[model samples]
Target chain A: MTTAPGSDRSDGLRLSGISKVLGGRTIVEKMELQVSPGELLCLLGPSGCGKTTTLRMIGGFLNPDAGRLTINGVDHTHSKPERRPTAMVFQNYALWPHMSVAKNIGFGLKVRKLSADKIRQKVDWALDLLGLQHHRETMPARISGGEQQRVALARALVLEPEVLLMDEPLSNLDAKLRVQVRETIREIQQRLGITTVFVTHDQEEALSIADRIAVMNNGRIEQLAAPAELYARPRTTFVAGFIGTMNTLDVGPAGGGVPLDDGALLPCDTFSGAAGDVCWIRPEDLQITEADHAGSVRAVVLRVIPRGHYREVLLQSHGSTLRAFTDGEPDVEQIVGLRATNALVYADDALVQDDEPARPGRAVRAVADSGDRG
Target chain B: MTATDTAPAAPAAPDKPVTPSSGARSPRRWSMLFMASPPVLLVLVFVGIPIVIGIAFTLGYTGGLNSIASMLSVSVYTANGWMPSLAAYGNVLSSERFRSDLGVTIWVTVLTVAIVLVLAWCIALYARLSGGRLGKMLSGIAIIPLFIPVVIGAYAIRQFYLNTGFLVSLGRQFGIQLPSWSYHTPGIVIGQVWVSLPFAVLLISSGLAAVPNALIDAARDAGASLGRSVWSVMVPMTTIPTVIVATFTAVGVMGSFTVPYMIGPTSPNMLGVTLQATFVAYLRPQDAQVIAVVLFVLAAGIGALYVWANARASRSSAVQL
Candidate 1:
């Protein structure tokens, strides 16, 4: 059999209009996404948001009802998982309980009928890469959860697959182990430069590990961009609320902008279809001050919680309650004022869809101004 | 912890150091004795006593070593009121008819167990993979044969093998002819297989269900071929139940009376039929009892072998776990 050329390093894995129907219910709608090569793309969504289903479709475990999946330039929608050069690490690890770590890692090579000596060499290399050589001969059950996860990664990587698909692989781990293992996974993916698609409901996991995060909601992609970019300039209200902490405000139209409930006119560049309302500001964007800063709005400090490195201040402004992440603890008993500048405004639960492409310079200016001022 | 500290310990303290009244001691001891007596008495009366009696019987008497010694001697039969019955052993071993009958019984048992297991595994696999209304219907269909009386099953199988029956009619329609059922060994095997297949399938299906789905998916994801997945994972995982089913089927086939009796001809008589003929037709209860005892020993040996193998296999799996 002629070996297929490596498509792993080529950027732009395009999923064009993919949909899936299962048990008479539409699981994944017409979804489209393009993940750059060497990019750790995470599909972040709540449970049953079709995140796992979309991953399975890409893995070829389930065939999409209608779609074209192309990695680099190769159309692989109909290919089997083994033939597609994709290796998946399941949430539960799904390591072969009957096989030793070495055997589990060497399984793909063995299936391909590699020489026994070559298989041993590759298996050893993979185990060493994962720092699991000491547990090479140990069965999966004999190892710790972290070690089992490492074994799973080693098994997937041994084949040198072009794409790595992870479905909540760290969720089974304890809280502490989850962070450690997730970091390890990110490091390994970066080092290998594999085109990885990670699926998780944990927003922190997606934001921390992924080069780009694709926020999914109701069987459709809400936004796809760099982790920080998506967080800072979320294209939809769902992405804004889902990715990070946000405080929504209800406002009515006033002076070509929106008037807050407290009768402050906030200048908004765009308006949602629903004319009378807009959601404003993220927690980190707001700052507590002795006096209102430039373009800062006044708010009452309701509750202040000291959270180790930062203090979370909940404030009420214009009949809407907002939370602010302050560097130091603010006066809780005294009536303190807070102001948020350069806040992103959302209409309903979605970002205002603009007809014109966003001006990058203006977006950067907005974010910089919002940085410390709240 | 708080609840425990708050509760009074006075009731529990009284039991720790008992200044026991004689009245309390007698009732407490008697109650304890009463509770323990039934199970102990049952064991002695049933298991312990029978085992002692069986050992005594095997040793050839209820009494002394002289009786055992005399029982072992050639002249013991002549000395005692019991007749010289060495002929019974000779008749069982030397007679070509008896040897043929034993061979037929063994052949039937082996063939029946083999066929039953194969068919059962197929049914079990179908039931597992296609678990829906259709699967339930197929499962119900498989059990239909079990509900049929063994005599009726035997008769139906014999009829199906006959020249004018369904098999012959179907064969005739397809321009083929079948052999008559009168003396067919294969027919006996088929009947036994049919009767035993449901139990095998039910046992094996339950075993197959216990195999973790994660294991199957792991094997598939690791690139094991479909056939290899079934053999390496499914079959190995369900081996214990399969062996159990096979053992039961084997023992059942070996001792089956109705199917072989109703369908098997006189010339190629099975051991059960032969034993029946000896006892009922020839008025030889003593000889029949000897054959019956031999059959019992053989079945018990097969069962023991299965139990031994099952234990070894289970121990290996447990060790792996």
Candidate 2:
């Protein structure tokens, strides 16, 4: 496969302006991308965002109506699925019901005309890799869901494909098992240095499992960057809102600052441009303080939710609701102040600036967690 | 069965794991049996009784209900006191005419069932995989015979292949020659396949429909060609319906009367025609009853295969799930 591991320039897999139209609807637009050798890239988007469609095109299951697909620098746009060096783990874990776990893992090898000894050795290796040796001869239907998932994974991995594709492999699992398998998949992908294209709708899963996350919306890639970079520097309003929970306030351009809903000018000093039209504020960055403090907006507490480790106090100021995380059990209707100098300012759906940082001295040290549930 | 007997039967695990209803189970059992009794009783009185009487008559018994057939037939084998005789069986089985007729019956049945299965599987598999106007039209053509009565279909099949009929005349007009096969076993097989195809296709296609597209895609992605995928995955998954089609077609062809009588030749005709000839033409009711018994036993043997296949499919699916 000419797979030079750690070679960032090697074209492990590339989709040059690929597109798909299903039933006369453009499901995936020009999707230009490249997966370097041994890199794991996640297609993160909501349902119907064409993540799975793109993955299928990459795997040769669905041919793109336009553009080309290349694996290892060879054009494979019109190749059949059997001719492509790619394997996919389906969302439902579509293991052959009639075949045992070992046979399923060995199926591709058998199709490749491998000897019996070679097939058995590869199957045994995969079973051990997935920790399914005890259930080697068990049929797919006889095993538990998690075990079936592992079998599906091992079946794909045994082929040693040039590029591995997964279409929401963890979407069928329970929350706890989803986390466990997600880590297992990531660890194996890293250990084997396989170039992978994983598609999932869960943002947290993409953030945790991907080396680089491609946030897609409306059949277009909104942003493609590392997990931390994409989270910190979301280029679009959709990306900012989609990556995490944030408060959005529509503000019009005004002299020296942006105007709020209540006709009060919320001073956005960090915004140097004259076209800032919306305000984005992370709840964690808001310092709970008194209204009389400098650079703080006056507000009234609308509701307080007990988010397991911290309290989420929703404050109303200038006719807009702002959420802030705090430890104190603030009563409803209590007046408070929210200071957010690091508020992400946007203009016409594009990020303008979020240059300033939160002043920790005045900030109420929030637990800095997002997984806690009320 | 009463609730007490149903308890031990329940302990013997079923193909499906039955939930123990514990409290309402006994009353529920009684109601189920009471509701089911009418049909069972009707079958016992009407169908079940006649079969037993017919077998007794074939075994050389000339008593009770057998007295009527023995009195009417030209020759009837009478049983000795307190013992069933095999004279009627030996008398019919040893005859060269009956042996040849039995051979013709089995040959036609096996050939018809095989052709029906191959054609039905092709049409259904094509419709399922390629799914469009052409596949639908092919299925529609196969099902057209279902709408036509067996009498009309058999007559049409025979006439269409005859030397002096429409097809031969058309071939003659084209200055081409073709052999007419009507009044032969091949013609009878053609007629039987045409009549049996609709049932087989409907059943087999329903099974193929249950095979999910995801599994097929998974197979293809695993480097299996279309043929291998169908053989390994689709065939195994649809075992129950396929078994049902085979057994039903075999049973239908073995005992069928209309198609064979209309299309088969006279000398070595299928047992269905031979049985009628022995009973009415030859005035030998005992010999005809013997042929009927043989056909029933053969059909029942095939039926056992269906039952075994069905039970195995259910048990395997249950365990897998």
Candidate 3:
């Protein structure tokens, strides 16, 4: 249930060449991105990837040392947080402790100098919308974590901000409550038709909620694409490994149609890349068969992980580990034939400069390590 | 990581059983009181007993029952022939000089408390926002007064404002004639503020520290200006501590003697200095007792406010928990 591309709509929020340096280290460097109106874009990354810092700059908590921030084609790069048309849902759910839930939700309207009647009406509407009528007069600290989260959301929503920025809003929730609240947040964003930028480290959270996901690494956006596209075809190894479970297998040489590490050579028509390329295969793309088969290699099963709908089979062959997904649980130490249904080759940038003889196992490890760095 | 984990089918219900802690609460209550007795006894002996004795003295019960009876009888004969007399209280309240002294004391207390609260809040807010080396230095300087002996501090303030003191001397060097402030109400207030400021600053800083930075950021994100955030968010969140600072500063200023005695005007000084004069200079211990009782009642009023605010703070927190 995601909206289509932003080309049909006006630009809601944009950041061009935004950079921030803290204590002589560049936290965010020359970052450029945009979001369309009525879109939920998730900045998916590991910690220290500058997602929160970017959100802060958009929210006007921190000024960018370079570049500009624009909302609706207007530059607000140096505007104060109060002057910016944005609101944030902090990770800690920073609800005012002394205020009742209703008052906390009404704070933004009151700050805008609205009449008491208007504030009351809007606050009541928000309270009803978030199903917080039962806790209208309850102090935030007296409520459950999920209810507090709803109050934090209502507090921002009442302002009708141009851009709603959420920083790991669901990280504080328990696993079960997380999914419940996640649905609530998504429903509200769509219902309000507001532009939203959500920063999170959970790929599942992004995949489930975002209209588009921007995978970040080392304070840079690696790729930005729809969830389906990002999963099917990742532009970088970091994106492939970070977006979902990906298995890397080594490929030998640039000619002779490329040889696989499992002693099988196939015509390389699916992928074209520089020398010293590695194959990135999703676990679901690999097939397992009987002990001996043509165009397949024999491998001993290492372990099986049951994932309800499917089992993930971990295999060891020629000192390299390979993973495959199947409906059956292959017994440990059982011999099996492995074949690739689909695979995308990526250039091994780190090993290309070494000039050493290509060890298929080492190439796989290097690609996996680079993905881990992201 | 599979999602399909479920509990087994329930069996037939059984009768409820009494919990061990629930049954043990009766005996635990006595042990709780036992644990609390030491501090309770210390407060009774050091604080409660002294207050009782002082009140008794103020009520004309000096040594024995015979002396107390004679004193009360004489007071009754002089006043309205009542068994218990209000003669001393009546006299102290009616005295013109004592009335003026009381006024001065009230004004000084109000002014000092206002000054201390405003300045301390500003300092605390500055430190909280800056959070740099300069902020650290300012906080350190603010707390330095707490370590200085009150007498020494009072003397230092007295010297600084005297005709030949550092301030007047500095003014002379700048070719500006300055008036001496020693033995004046302004000088006394300055000294009292210096002495009382550190406590207010500490309490205010602690309160500001207790509020998470995220709350302030949230306020700003919600479109609150700096002043609006401070008044609507920061100040309200720190109500308990601000009230505490007010109560402590008011009580301390009302009962303080050294600062005013060293720097206040002799004619219309605080009741603390007058109380001292009434007891030692005039040798009127009965009058001093009456004045002291008035002072105690005033301080007790502020103490009651503090206790109420503290109770509300704790009760709300308990409800939250």
Candidate 4:
């Protein structure tokens, strides 16, 4: 869905069959994506998954070996980074160490040969926008880490780039500052309604900030959906594992159930389609209870790692080890019964639809887009 | 020369002990003084004292160390009751020959520094951006001059640009009359540039290479062209090292004797050759020492510029950190 910024700006980023090969290795496969104006789409993946490569290509820093990249109906596949209406906030911020904060923000305008008054006005506005007015005279190195990051953001935002690209921009910040800055970025992106592509390896970060998350693996997009949609109906095992903690058990038709390590058949004919199918369960969906429940598989609590808001219980099952999230801690070595609810099933590395069909993966075409995500 | 060689570098020495204040008598402070004494003592004895005594001799102190030189000279300006005489300074300063030599020396030093810096920046920027084999080879080849003995290099350069040299002969083949640099001001400039290039390239290239790639990329992304990015970002970032090369090259060229003596014109010469000719050929020892003092003052001006540059760079960088 699109948001309010789409109302004023008609520009959107479109990449069709884009591919990149670096050093004889295909860093990004034939990736296709269309980000609506004013939407913040995250290229979410682990290291070397090509998410950053895709973002770099979109930013015009790197050209796609194949495929066409268009923005606002204009082809810019071979355009230089400056020629394209895109600005990137690099992982390291890339602020000019020699320039003051105001100068750093105004550098793009200065390059455009804008009048001094105009450049200064825009830089001041950017400083106020990022709440960095006091740091105008400060050098990048003299500022604190968070302040440096904001200056980098202001430097990009001052350009009013049509497409905003960030390469792990929050990775340099501490955990506390990371959340704060990401929220700030999200608010700014929404308020401005610029089409933004954020690349990150942190799944939680993607789930927290993105209008849609494109999960990548091995130079290909594994799944592209809203956070809830991805968690609920991950198209592949990789998506399920990458997006959240996934517990998979092999299913077969022998006992019309899933096969555990102990040769016990946990009946799952309702969720799976065929033999060798995988029953994917998110930790929270796996109900581990002290008392035996209907259709429950016997498991032993091996470890309990308290995770602030919830406890993560590692269980030794009949056939394999499985992890389940619980509110209360279960004693190690205590036997428990676990049952899956609303689990996804996959066969041959693909979703095997049995009953719960995925919600239609369609975005609002620049009309209904909002910062809100399911 | 030996003192500069034996002294530890001033900056970023890992074990440089900090001085303890308020008479705390820290072992580290003692170590700092001890480590520092060798260069200080050597410079004071071998370099510093001689310079002072030489300056005194120039000011008409023609006794003890100056006695031997005073006996050999014809018109020695003698001091009165320990009062220094300005007659020797007046004699050297008033000479049209000495004035011409000073002017030529300044011009050559300035020209050499400018050319060397430009060439070094070209090579350094090429290596930094393209990182191609050709740039590296060119940079490596530039350093060969540093290894070659200056006398041999100067002599070879003179031969290559002589009136009947290979370059002149080649121009003759094309029916062109090319002016030779031999026994000319341009010849000294060329020789100085050639000899100074190795250090310039070495420092400047490394300084440029040390600039983070992201800053350049960011500049390019900000709509600056490659040249603009280098001018605005890389140049300012590399001020200290570049200034160091510039100052050192100027000093080296100004005080250089071999290249100027081997290649420059006999008259209207750089002060390096004039100082030699005055003391040895004409036997005007006091006047020559006056010229030496003049040369030192000029070089001290450049050295002061270097110190100011270094201090400003450190101040800015320290604030940044």
For each candidate, the alpha-carbon lDDT, in order, equals 0.75, 0.84, 0.82, 0.84
Q: What local lDDT score does residue A355 receive in model 2, on the 0 to 100 scale?
A: 41
Question: After superposition, which runs of candidate 1 have C-alpha atoms over 4 Å from their true positions?
Answer: A1-12, A252-276, A290-306, A316-319, A330-334, A353-374, B1-98, B130-136, B173-175, B212-214, B267-321
DockQ of model 3 vs. true complex: 0.71
**Per-model TM-score versus the true fold:** 0.80, 0.90, 0.86, 0.90
* Candidate 1 residue-wise lDDT, B66-155, digit = tens: 354344333322112233335455555787887898899998888888888888888888878667887778777888887888999898
DockQ of 4: 0.57
Q: List the residue pairs that clash in candidate 4.
A: A1-A364, A1-A369, A2-A369, A3-A369, A260-A319, A261-A318, A261-A319, A262-A318, A262-A319
Sort by DockQ, top down from the best: 3, 2, 4, 1
In model 3, residue pairs whose N, Cα or C atoms come closer than 3 Å (at least 3 residues apart or on different chains), thus clashing, are: none
Q: Residue pairs in steric clash, candidate 2?
A: A141-B320
lDDT, residue A177, candidate 4: 96
If you assessed candidate 4 against the hidden native complex, which CAPRI class would it receive? Answer: medium
What are the chain B TM-scores of all models?
Answer: 0.74, 0.89, 0.84, 0.89
| Clash count of each predicted structure | 3, 1, 0, 9
lDDT of 3 by residue, B1-321 (tens): 345675553553367544556554858978999999999999999988867766665565555433443353333212232245566787889999999999999999999999999989889899998898887778778999999999999999999999899989999999999988888888988998999899998999999999898999999989888888888889998999999999999999999999999888898999999998887787666778789899999999999999999999999789768
Among all windows of ten consecutive residues in candidate 4 chain B, which has the lowest summed lDDT? B16-25
Q: Which ten residues in a row have the lowest lDDT in candidate 3 chain B?
A: B73-82
| lDDT for each residue of candidate 2 in A1-374, tens digit (9 for 90 to 100) | 34334434467888889999999999999988988899999999998899999998887888999987888887788888888889999999999888889999998899999999999999999999999999999888888888899999999999999999999999999999999999899999999999999999999999999989999998899999999998877888999999987877787444433345756544433442335677676777676776444555567899989999999988887777788888877789987755555556678888875345322331222211110110
Here, model 1's chain A TM-score works out at: 0.85
Worst 10 residues of 3 chain A by lDDT: A349-358
